[model samples]
Target: MEFTETLLPGVGVRYDGQSRDGQPIAIVVAHDGDVEIVTYQRTDPDAVQYRLELAAHAALAVAELLGSPRVSARLVDLTREIPGLHTRRLVVAPGSRYAGRLLGDSKARTRTGCSIVAVVRGPDVIAAPAPDFTLLAGDTLIAIGSERGLEALAELLGLTPDDPVPVMTAPV
Candidate 1:
């Protein structure tokens, strides 16, 4: 979930990170508005495994498909209506203990008192996912709970507050 971003001077920005499967990946945003998603081999970091090129419009479409805006709006509205309620996005990263495990195995709700309302994987959103649902690497969990509970859930997912991973939450 943590990535390093480097400014490319006259170009744009380059984000480097490791994939959920331990493969190196780089995302480059060009000044011309194009985006490239590249994956490298585990053995050779510089060797290209595959590359996906997206135009500005295509990138926006992909973002919409991921439902960031819609989900954020709904979470914001819910938080605004309730006191001490918050929402956060928790990513299942590589090496996570829960990766490839069942949602019920984590006992997230029983342990942290946080409800995982949705699971966003690639272009698919599994709303109200069952406890039997399997969690895969790269899956983004949309959880709603108190701040303390959410922080606990993050720790359960092997993330600390100091991690660079973005914990997007609605304004209290």
Candidate 2:
């Protein structure tokens, strides 16, 4: 089955599972060294376009208007509620080791409580990554997880401590 719905501004690819209400919401929990894009047949065409992983009801109200999930709702809160949680950011450039493979697999990354919230690849922005996603050179990954766990991911991906982000250097 195919859905012809327009690509909402924030609705890109789902990376996780279930919205806060226990409603079915797929999200891209991580984008470490791979690219994960999930596609599911919207069981209901009239299905509410607004879906949020927000832990609160207030943000869900705004999500309804956008017809797509807002990333801020998933992140940011980590600092407040997660006490001692760490968000790991991986910026892959030409020389970085993760230049060509799928990085974000929920089962794999989540093992360490790290989820990939965003992947900035060139001009496009991917919301989340499902398993089997691969990462290419010059991709910027914004991941959230424990500090130690994230550090391990950095090593596995071959990202050094002082590499510049590919997105910032790309000519505008």
Candidate 3:
């Protein structure tokens, strides 16, 4: 549909969590990157959903429209979505060999979709660290990537997504 999905600066806002029934609701983002929730008495939320579907139908009616998602060569070539594309955090122990394994074995990140953005060691911080940067004890790794990527890192780092990091002293 010639959707400008590459419009990297776009944003989406919605109410989520177990509190909501998992309905797809739409919210607005201002030109300044602020999120505004969609509420009642303003635009009919249900009607808005219907209108979006109708717009999709109209788009489908176009003879030249392509419904399938296609990856752009530039996106794949640059891997623009891998670096600062998304972010997650990992608090590793003061010292661990996992640091070597992560940067040494990038395929795990490539496959799972996570990239180490930076490492916070105590009061000092290193941003855009090289792949060879060795991790020290009490190092906080700032990572970014897809959900699966985050999960893979968690597994390798031996911590749950929300668990407090314990000292990794179990002999590597």
TM-score of each: 0.55, 0.43, 0.39
| Predicted candidate 3 versus true structure: per-residue lDDT over 116-139, tens digit per residue | 766766545577678667665467
Best by TM-score: 1
lDDT for predicted candidate 1 compared with the true structure:
0.80
TM-score of 1: 0.55
- What tens digits encode model 1's per-residue C-alpha lDDT throughout 4-58? 8888998887889988888779988776658899998768867878999999778
Q: What is the C-alpha lDDT of each candidate?
A: 0.80, 0.52, 0.47
Best by lDDT: 1
Cα displacement (Å) at residue 135, model 1: 0.1
**In terms of TM-score, how similar is model 2 to the real structure?**
0.43
The best-first sequence of candidates by TM-score reads 1, 2, 3
Higher-scoring candidate on TM-score, 1 or 2: 1
List all candidate RMSDs to the true structure: 10.0, 15.2, 14.0
Candidate 3: segments with Cα more than 4 A from true spot: 1-85, 94-102, 105-108, 159-172
Instruction: Report the C-alpha lDDT of model 2 over 1-172, residue by residue, as the tens digit.
Output: 1122232344343334544454544443222212232334468733445533443344455455645444543565555477766665577766654566556422336444466777766556687765566777767677776677676656555654365432211111
Worst 10 residues of 2 by lDDT: 28-37
